[model samples]
Target: MNITLKFLLLAIFSGVVHLDTMVFGQFMFSRPIVVGPIVGYFFNSPQTGLMIGVILELMYISVIPIGIKIPPDATAATILSVVFANIRECNDLGMPMSIFFGIIFSLVYKFTDIQIRTLNNMYLSWVDTAKAEFVEKRINLLVYYGIVVSFLRTILFYLIVLPIIYFIVKNVCVLIQYCPVKENFRDIIYILPAIGVGIGIAHFMEE
Candidate 1:
């Protein structure tokens, strides 16, 4: 598949996962372990996707959303990481850098989530106004508007972040060619999943 088309599909999938949070479904499609391999499969790199997914899944396994408290946006993180890794063709390095940037993107998405919730609240206020006016159609429109707004948020995020990550990864790859890194760097990547698993086990034991 073309890179642009892959990105578009990823954006749509991320939007659906974002919608799954509240608007339509609560299925675990957004989970890192699930989304990671899926995105990787799109790039014909399911192993890369599965590796990143396992690491992220274990890392964030303990975080749970309660009421208005939002957990980190693991869905966006996993998608971005897999996309970056695939774009850079980092099969040997195991996408360690991509995973790092993915975590960063997840943090950024948390703020986006807050802003989106604020927008949703505004829409809810509009819905209330529609209710007051006794216009059922207006109320329905407002509800649908809210859902569209949520989907747009993911699309906008993709548009903004993807290019930035691409440039950074491209430059970093260029730099790595000049700098001779240790041979064990790839081995380091392999160790991350084990660490994630250990953390997950600890979390489970604590619970």
Candidate 2:
């Protein structure tokens, strides 16, 4: 496959799939089918992506993003990490490396969450300003703001953060693999599923 074509397809997939809303928040990127395996498919390694997703899916299954607690953005990390691993020929530990990067990606999400909130506030203020200017057109004002905010948020995030993450995934993942904690993290790869299953059983019993 031509590198340019592969990158273009990945970029388009990344741009469209990464956006989050209340409903999409529940699934989409959070699920293996949508984010990880789908990205793996683009990488010409759907089975690898699926295997990695299964491991990651179990690992993070219990860690819900409730309230202000920012869980890792596994979706972003998985897509780029899988792509990088595939391209760089890190098949031996590709998935583990992807999960490791996922943790870092989650941390980035945490650090920048306040900024997103501020952006939301700023966008809301614009809506308020419009409402004041056109009292009779309040509905239109809000609609405009919603459209603008949604599009800008998605596009801007991709334009800025996605490229940065992609660069790091491509260049720095090898370093990440050699960390001292690598062995311990492999242990988590085993334990995470048991924890996920426990959570599932607990939820089932409660219901």
Candidate 3:
């Protein structure tokens, strides 16, 4: 596949997956377990995707989005982990570093998510002020508008983030290659799942 076309597809995928979080039914298609592998598959790295996804799933099992409260961006983290780990430039960055970057990316991604939500709310307030007779139609229009805006927002964000993050991770990978600790990084990734599982199980522990 052409490099430009590959990026276009990934951008579209990011937008579509984001919809499952709220713009569409929360069927969990955006969840790490699902999004990770699908994204990995697109990159011809299904195993890498699933591994990252499962780890992220365990890490974020309790982060349910409710009301106006913002949750951590698990989908962003998982997708990014898979993307970074499998990228040609980041091939030596290791999964642990990829996942580390992904987690950070997810946190940073929340700011953009907030901006979109705030913008949407501002528009929603306008819709509430529409004349009575056409209010219903206006709301319906707003719903469609919100979906498109939300979708485009993610794609644009992905386009901006992908290269920047890739560049940083690639450089970091080069700098860390000769570090003694780098040899043991794989062990950390191996241990993360256990820690993640503990975190997840603790969420359900009765007092």
**Top TM-score prediction, candidate number:** 3
* lDDT comparison, 1 vs 3, better candidate: 3
- lDDT (CA) per prediction: 0.79, 0.59, 0.85
TM-scores, all models, native as reference: 0.88, 0.66, 0.93
lDDT of 1 by residue, 97-138 (tens): 788888898889899889877866665655565645567877
Candidate 2: tens digits of C-alpha lDDT, residues 1-207: 876566666655654565453213445554654577788877678876776676666656665778877676666556655665574734355555656676576566545545665665654554456746565476666665655554455445544655565566555556656677665554544554576577667766873
Q: In model 3, how large is the Cα lDDT of residue 144?
A: 93
Cα error, residue 144 of model 3, in Å, equals 0.4
Kindly list the per-residue Cα lDDT of model 3 for residues 1-207, writing each as its tens digit: 975677778989999999998789989899999999999899888988898998999999988778889998999998888888876654545688889998998887888889888877677767677888988898888989989998998898788888887888888877787678766675676787897799888999947
Ranking of all predicted structures according to TM-score, beginning with the best and ending with the worst = 3, 1, 2
Which sections of candidate 1 miss by over 4 Å?
89-91, 127-139
| lDDT top scorer | 3
Q: What's the CA error at residue 6 for candidate 2, in Å?
A: 3.1
